[model samples]
Target: MTLDIVRLLELTGWRAFDVDDRGRVLAGSDESGSMQLVELADGERTDLTALPGAVTGRYLPGERAVVVQHDSDGDERAQLSLLRLDRTGPAELADLEPLVDDPKHVHRLLDVLPGRIVYATNRRNGVDFDVVIRSARSTEEHVLYDGGGLVGEVAVSPDSRYAALTVPAAPALSDQLLLADTMPETRADALRELTDRRAAARHLHLDWLPDASGLIVTSDFGSDRTRIELLEPRSGRRHPLVTSDSCDLSGSLSPDGATLLVQANDDGATRLALHDARTGAHRLDVEPPTDGWCGHPMPAPVWSPDSRFVALSFSGPTAPGDVLLVEAATGRCHPLTFSAAQLTGEDPVEPTAHRIPARDGESIPCFRYAPHEPDSRTAGSAVVIIHGGPESQSVRAFSPIVQALAARGHTVLVPNVRGSTGYGKRWYSADDTRDRLESVADLADLHAWLPTIGVDPDRVALWGGSYGGYMVLAGLAFQSGRWAAGVDIVGISSLESFLRNTAGYRRAHREREYGSLTEDADFLRAASPLNRVSAIAAPLFVIHGANDPRVPLSEAEQVVAAVRDNDLECELHVYQDEGHGLAKRRNRLDAYPKALDFLARHLSG
Candidate 1:
């Protein structure tokens, strides 16, 4: 039976953001066509914000209101607004009390206390993000740390006396920790650097200890994998709370400060456990109903104020995303949101993990999804989907697009090439800076290895968004004959133009991964797919958000124009209301079906 692409894409997933003391959950759900903020309590759901674009929020300390962060279209310059729980129904844009509404600069709400809220903003100079502490009641605000670089994470102490911040040290691979005095008026020396820049490693998830004695930090300072550490900011003493030899461990201290929730990422699967916060002793192992990926890069598990329960979102190959609540004492997990119940079918197809040997003797880890039902039209056809974030890994999570492709009888392969995180520190940094093209070579290696899996190389099509989109164009241009068609979405055409025209705040950070324009302009131009547009022989389809701050709309425009000048079949679809990717369902319904049609036309001989 052929699955309706529209129905498959419409299946909703939920994400838990914050859980209050009374166990009221602040979450994001797409049940209403677009992702909107909703408060879940006592088996009832109340829509909190019906504003434009997807909304994410955290509950205020009192649970009477929420701090909602919303952006226009898909433009990620999110503005902060306060929405009270006392509303009779779903609150509209007019009902939200604007907290920070500067459309020109980006404002990220970090942490909230009883009387104040702390956020990182580039309002000062529009390039550097300064940690700003603002009064929740008034307009008074002051910069807590104006040092430099992108502020990655921020946490305010329970007593509101101190603040902790983490900034990127080696871009995606490592971070430097900084501790600042919140009450700087009384002290001459305010900010202190806890980690040395020379020995920088990945340091993040800043959860301050309840008593302000130290912090439960997640860092891979002296090891290959990340572990939880108890760091005394004042004395600079460190103690390991969680350790793993093969997998990277991420942990969060419970609100009561008595327990620690630790999650280990072994390849793509997630293993969650609990520990004694003070002694680092193992307590209980949390077992979800199915094997799935959880924690980090996603919203971290949020603990209830009383520390009796922890709420987190979980997803797997067969499971769409749902918020889960785990009791701390018994380790019993219950699903708060059953998003899969709405879908009408057997479970989505599960992917099998495979290791394909590359030409350089390196093994590429990939997941393959076979068709649920075979179709003659797409027989021997395969889609090689690349993930965005050359730094991110394609984990075992529910993807409507991946499912939709398989339902149409196309073999889908998702590979974690070099530079994709979750394997180890060395693997992620393998394609950094000048070594960028090395990751793209992994695509070529995958193409050559396709015959062994019964997938015809001549029928293979490249598909991806963002950085993955760049890989699609690169594979089609550099290895033109290897692929039949390409679909690029908000992807960069020229690394030189991407670095030069990208938002100011993003340039310095992105430079750490992709080479710097000032020094590596020549190398960037040589590596860009647009530089070798004449070499591309495959038909191409491009989709882009006009307001994309990361990969500008000009990228899609220039590449499509150049490819068409070669008398090639290249089509471009621009969504004026979208940013980096399509957020609205209406745009997705039109864009994806068209892209699939393009693939069908090119893939069928």
Candidate 2:
């Protein structure tokens, strides 16, 4: 599945924030960098927004409209808009209207019901999010509950009488639930402490069973990885349903609420399980076509309006992310779109999932891609692609760049370093604050381990975005001689500056992982890669989104400037219309080519 650079780029597509009520896939195709929304049924795509940043939208539950999420210049403060599509109309943008267009606030549409929407926004005071019930037809809105902490992830009951909110238990990064009554007679302001922080669940996912008996929630209450439980809204007692050694979460509930889809991260790849909602019985287990793919964050498996099929998007080593419709009854999967309009050539060179031993004797898991087309040499170069989130895992997802590099004779190693998710809580929190460099050492260890696996040591390169970008800088600084080059994408240079400069709303959550500036200023600076620029002995390539609020543009600016002052070869690219990463295809088309050329020039095995 090694596609040509441009062809590989063109073939990658992902499911949008939407799967029409009919379950017909409306995806963001990769042909254009702007993320054009394509109706996968017919391969027709239409631009939904004018912005260049990333775009994710959901088709309103029962309406002929969609609610699109976008932010200006890559700032985390996003704007929401409603586009009531008119297939009969002549123009695409004709029926669009401003839904929530505030500059200082971040608006997230949690759930859309028959005639209303459950939304969370920091517009209340620009600090913490407040859950609100807004009329789908009018501007009428009512504050359901105002919690001091992060009042996000609003899940509305089927009858539209109740809403569930996830409030962060800060410092620990765990979360609890807040139940709000949204019925006409019931007091909207009356909120109940649905769950407590004493028994914390790091990831709280909620979904109302069809009859609204209570909620089907996935929590880490009594298990290391998350487990599915049925929470009785009245008694506030939970009945355990599905528990596993791997990370598991509740997926969509059937219309009648009988079948509940559950996705679990068994090792690095995902396994799909279907449970009987009423009995808490595991009825069936279904894995996607690909053995390893991402199912946690975005484009999760969605159930059809009929509840007979579950639509899921996944990416493997050679395959770009593809959408599959699974038949719930028969356990059969049918491809909606193979993460694109078409996937050309033979099966992609599937990656081998293996564990590399770490210095601390812990096992670090990774997906290794050996190039299908290697150079005419006994040994070839290697590249380690790091994932962001520090809370995120680098599964065997379809990444065009990774596949392209492998095709170009470079072995791509995507490691799930210590701090990454899917490995359980202890491993995920292993790289907190001062211990962050240990995660970089995990990469260095992978670099050192490459020789044993037949990769040339001197030609290895480091590549990552955001926190992973920070890893790039950390590798270049702390392990100067270990790499041939480094490619950093929107990485942080200073933890202290990032904490202070990031949007006011996101600082607290970030501090829970990275050290807090108020307490760890010196340690933060010492840990910052920009402070150790003199030790970076490799050619560096930096990419950033000017509107990136998490790692501000200044983070990239300072590093590029400082690295240039060291009299080394440092190439910096800043996209004005992009943020954090290249959301717009035009920006990616320009940026990635430079990346390929840079890797080729520096990684000469």
lDDT of 2 by residue, 220-288 (tens): 776667778888988988888777775645456676788877777766667777878787778887755
Candidate models: Cα lDDT each? 0.86, 0.75
TM-score of 1: 0.97
Writing each residue's lDDT as its tens digit, candidate 1 over 1-605 gives 34557876777878999888777888889877688988788999887777778888887786588888888988889888888888788888899888888998899999887766788898888889999887767888878898888899998888877888988775556788988897776556788889886664888788988898999998888887889999998899999988989998898888779999998886687888889999999999886754454423256888988898888987776566788888899787778888667664564788888998998899998999998777898978999999999888898888888888888889999999998988878788888888888999999999999999888889999999999999999998899799999999999999999999999999988987888888888999999999999999999999999999999999999999999999999999999999999999889999999998899898875
Candidate 2 Cα outliers beyond 4 Å, as residue runs = 19-23, 40-53, 89-94, 183-189, 198-200, 246-250, 287-298, 339-343
Clashing pairs for predicted structure model 2, backbone only: 1-348, 33-584, 33-585, 34-585, 322-339
Model 2 root-mean-square deviation? 3.0
TM-score to true structure, per model: 0.97, 0.92
Q: Per model, state how many residue pairs clash.
A: 0, 5
